[model samples]
Target chain A: MTITLQEVLPTYFEESRRHQSEIWGKQLTFNKGEYIKIVAPSGSGKSSLTHFLYGLRNEYNGKLLYNGQDLHGYSVEDFARYRKDHVSIVFQDLRLFPEQSVRDNLELKRQLNPYHGPEKITEMAERLGIGSKLSVKSRICSYGEQQRVAIIRALLQPFDFLLLDEPFSHLDDNNSKKAMELMLEEAAARGAGILFADLERIDFFPWQRLYHL
Target chain B: MALSFQPIKPLLQTGTNAASRWFSYIGLGIGVLLLLCSIQMYINIQQLLGGDSPRKDGHDFISISKTITDETMGQLEKNLFTEADIKDLEGKPFVSGVSPLLANNFRFQLSGGSLVPFVTDFFVESLDDTFIDTVPPTFHWQEGDEVVPIIIASDFLEIYNVFAPSYGLPQISESTATNLGLQLICYYPDGNRATFRGRVVALSDRINSIIVPKTFLNWANQRFATTKELRASRLYVKTKDANSPDFLNYLTEKHYKVNKDKTKFGRVKQVLQGIFSGLGIFGLLVVILALMLFSFYLQLMIARSKDNLQLLLMLGYSPNWLSTNVARRFIPVYILVVLFAVAATQLMQWAFHHFAMYDREELTTWLHWSVFATAGFLIALSLFTNYRMVKRLLYRMA
Candidate 1:
């Protein structure tokens, strides 16, 4: 029953799994510093599986385990606490409040971890190349700029794992590559595992392991 | 396994989900309107009741009265005015004028046997001539016998059915105008006859009634002394001193009465009391229902906005923050609704003033304060409901 990261690799999937097919996995695991990439076609249930893992959708008939315990043991408050203190998600739509500023977006993330200082917002803004644009409203920024801010916001929060769902969707090749590099560097510094969902774009940075849904 | 009433989240993705959202807005609107109306009603009632409840004017020294027929005298004793007392108080500025005397409808069965009833109000007099001034000899006494001049009511011509210049009656000619006489065949239920020879001089249009020389009344009484019956109702009065409480007291002690027309006051009071009491009740009902509906809408909106709230909740915002934020959003709407209600009430009062000829004070006072207070109550209700809804939602979610 011991969960390991290697067994969750996409290349190790069975042939019975087809596109739009439902699959169940038990005893799933990720090492503290692992970099895992999951790829599928447009309708291959990659987002669905990601939502399941993030605790956003829980109707599926399967067991989700963490640290050798069933996921049901975690209540909504527990999930919220985990999202605030040990996990963060970068949504596919770059779901930022349009009325807020880039700095505030990141600051909101920092607030999730009560111990995080305000200086982290400035540091993250500089790293995301949005330091000058921090005061700018989110809607006013270009897609690439917004993408960077979203990633930076996700990073500002205290977390041991990052779930990125098509975080590079709107970016051009060069910006996407740069954003991927920055994301990896931030996650690696914190020794957090990064589970990224992507289409068949084939342009993502090399990952330590890949899961095909 | 213990079950929870969790939201069916999967159903929300469809467009049909928007129906509930629109419904929530409608509920909110109704609730707000109810609260506003209730507040308006309460204020109006307070204003009408003279700041608390209904009240009537207390009796005072200058108690005016009216005297009806002797047959109805017992019934009118509680409200009677004496003739001499009325005449004595004629000149007082504070003594508002007595109302014009109401007369019985008189029918003149003409010589042609046509029955015609004419409405008449004539000033009566005794033979004393105390209140009458003699016309100068140059004023041309139109007479044939004793030359007793009689100033007739203008409407006397209408009752006689004799158009002097147009009817072509011989005795009413221009040369004999000074000596024209009226032989009125006065008939009661029994057969009757009367010859009244008097010179008709001037026409009067003073008030809603007609005036006559006091002598003419005496002439009628003397001419039919054995047959004519007379009744005196009231003597129109003006007081020499309006603030003469002593005079009023003296009149009271003498078993005499003074009556001032307070119909205007009574009418104004009744109309105002009626309108404002209804408005207060309506507004109160609206607020109560509105509070309920508003609270319901707030709860529903909280449920609808659950995901957004959850995001914030996950972002380490305290439950109190969500409550404050939700309550703050409704503050402006509540304020606007209340203001609209108050403004509407004032506008309605203004309209009443513009159209109503009677009393504007009653309408104005009720609307001005009623709307304001109601609006305040609605605003507070909205805030309170919003806070409670958000708090409950947060507790449930937790």
Candidate 2:
């Protein structure tokens, strides 16, 4: 799967800001099994760019093509199918259901694709140092724990591309490194690509290509 | 890897407000009950007005007489109806048929051991056999037959009961009076005498005089009368509709007196039917309003659950799928409401049958097919309306 952007400019962003960014009014293509990093300063529409790619935001100028098909022509059901089978996202806000436990949060997405099971979730939770918190409600968990839970939930479904929007903002350096390694291993095993957005680059993970948003 | 992929249960309970749901159910149930009862009452009134078992004379026939005045009272023979009067009555558009009543002129004495052992004069009147109700096969007399079959007026029994106590005579029951045989002695004006046995065959509330068979009257009147020409004092007029304005107006214009007691009673029945029909319509209106209120309540609940529904949609569930989940919650309530409403109607019908109309044999059932059909129609309408409302709300949210 590949996503191609041609001179894409979000409608909400000021036109003057486009001159400062390399991605604005520039053609970019993301291919399968490639890790790309979007590095930008604060207030640079990193979340907007992720939402646009995930079909959540459409108020943008220029055309977005998904595997040679125009994104604008896709119906709601088509978008839903795309999200279920091809693309997965870890939202910046980590939209976890407050009433459900971490396991329930992870199980909700896992139910859509049955390739992964509870043992995989437990192994990932143990590796992330949040195994004991899986049975507890997501609302009572710490921000870092919730972020880790969201990461596990996003990875539960089969996807060609994983979109991450400042997913490691609440984590410490050591935990972020651990989470990155876990994500890299999963993506490598599935032969999927990763689009990570952040304010700064981390030295531990190497990216095949870097774009300034 | 044993990942448990259970879809999360909804956080907000969609059981609905029990009190409000039940309140709506009760309101609807009462509406249904009122509708059923009104239909039952309307049927009962219809039976009373038109049923053949209770009314001795059908609504089609009416007995009429000329109005008595001082001049006509002084000359009673002048008031007697001739063949011209019968022909005139039959010529009217409303009058289907007319039969003149015949009266016995000879004196007759009735002597029975059990009751009425008097030797006074008794008068007998007769009309066409078709005008009488419940005519026995033996009412016709052969040449050798001496027993006479008579039909006495039911009001005559009431009058006799009222006067018997004062006259120091025993008041007899209907069964005993029917069984008592009386010997009749006819005294002719020429001093000839004859004897015959008499038996009461039937009783009638419509006919106000003693009724004998037309065959016997013609046979007896031929042998005993001084003249051959027969003049009737009363005539039974069969009209298409007794309450028709034209018939009443014609009777009034001719100064003829008709028995309007049955027609008046029929009018009262029609008024009852109108009132019950109005009440039934009111009940149906209440049911419609209650259903609207219930639909509004469901819309509110769906609105309250909008966030969760949208979240489910975002998780790749179709809007129709979510709507089905919401609709499933109310299906039981809908079934229960219909069942309860129908059950309450049936219970009311049972109570009416065993209690309210216990003595009325003509009213056999309070539950009519129309009642069930109406209730079924209302239930289906409510369920369909509710389902459509839910689907519309879900689609809008989507």
Candidate 3:
């Protein structure tokens, strides 16, 4: 059950980056029923690469073959539709609206990319132990709480691949391990790939493959 | 320790920090002031345009005899007699009557005091019994009441200095008051003496006046008949159609001089109205200008605070999203400013009214709406300017 890149790329790519200069030499593929992790330092180009793959950066001058269809074949709008429908990102900084409550923040994301009913939010909140803190302001919450909120927000969306940028950097060892396990379990249930990057070397959870950039 | 080489984030926030704070204060101040001005202007315009309210409709038109010995009348004839002027006069709809007369302000002295009438008296062959009877001292009396004793203001009272040695200083107490019930003696050069006694029915203390009946006044004048003079120093006419063009045309064609009289009570009212309207409009203009200045300052402040906006962009939020977020935060500030302006204007108007300062009605109406409207306008303008500034700054940063 190999997940073809063409099948996943159109879900995230409004504009295909098959002919991007940066991804010209990189092999692009998504395998179903498997999780792939990309680890990189803070300043490394991992974020850039993710953007390139997601069709956010259109100036790449390389061949990115998503199941033999060049990434450049799609337009910018096509890539946005793909991102909206299939790709989700748990930002390193969490990218939460500080003015809004934690629950409202999650609600906004769910509305923007609702894969399931509101029941999914409850499930995610319970899994993250953020059920009680839903109405709290995101700014007032602990780093670990914010991290889980970010992850839950991304997990609630229906996507083939989840981009996690230092998703568990703020969590303690116990919470980090538990959050990572839950994330992997949720990804597996959805049959989605969890791609994450962090400054520290984290290795408690199991992964099918890891790449250092 | 090797410092990892990292590229700086491309987004940069621009502008000064104090811009918003400065603008906020300035904008609010201006908004409030302008709002007051607008209120005043509105009231002035209402008065000028003649609202249906009784006070607003108070005699704004003047009927002057064109034949008047006055600089004002002369100016009017010279500047306002063109065919175009006639059309303008017709359109303005002020009925004018003409009479060739010189208006004189006379200080009539009597035994008790001097009286300066607001409306000067010119002899009519037959004194309108109804009109004179309706006049005060007469109004104080009732039918079947005892023969109303009318007091006469003597030359002594008229010349009674406010700082006279005998009076020390004039006061409202009885010691300073002239004996209203007492009458000593009256005399003439003919050596005949008459005892005239009358109870003081009314005394206008402000003007130090003791008014008597026209009959007594005429009888007293017989001794001073040599000083009798006939000069039409005043031309008096009242008309329901005072603002009509035909009346003005009739006066003009008759070659009688007409001047709008400000000294007369009726004409003075019109003058006051004109002055009030002018002041109100001027005040409104000043307030509006102040509000605009404040709005400009407010935009500058908001532009400065946009540094956080760049950070949002790095999080993949677009320019439109950032603008919406900024606007949301700023809207509350403007609403607060508007509320403050309204409250402040009301307070100021109330203060003025309490002190009997400037015209209360005009001032109140101007302040109430002007402040709030100015505040609203400033907020909107500030937001618009802030939007453009943010857009331009972001484009540069991008």
How high is the lDDT of residue B333 in model 1? Answer: 60
Report how far residue B129 has shifted in candidate 1, in Å: 73
Individual DockQ of the candidates? 0.12, 0.21, 0.04
lDDT value, residue A40 of candidate 2:
84
Single out the weakest 10-residue window by summed lDDT for candidate 2 chain B.
B1-10
User: How do the residues B333-358 of candidate 2 rate in per-residue lDDT, one tens digit apiece?
Assistant: 66676667767777776777678878
**1 or 3: which has the higher lDDT?**
1
- Across B166-187, the per-residue lDDT of candidate 3 in tens digits comes to 6453433333343444342334
Task: Looking at model 2 chain A, report the run of 10 residues with the lowest lDDT sum.
Answer: A109-118
Superposed on all Cα atoms, model 3 deviates from the true structure by an RMSD in Å of: 15.3
- Using DockQ as the yardstick, the better of models 1 and 2 is 2
Model 3 chain B lowest lDDT segment of ten: B1-10
| Candidate 3 A-chain TM-score | 0.77
Best model per TM-score: 2
Global lDDT of model 2? 0.77
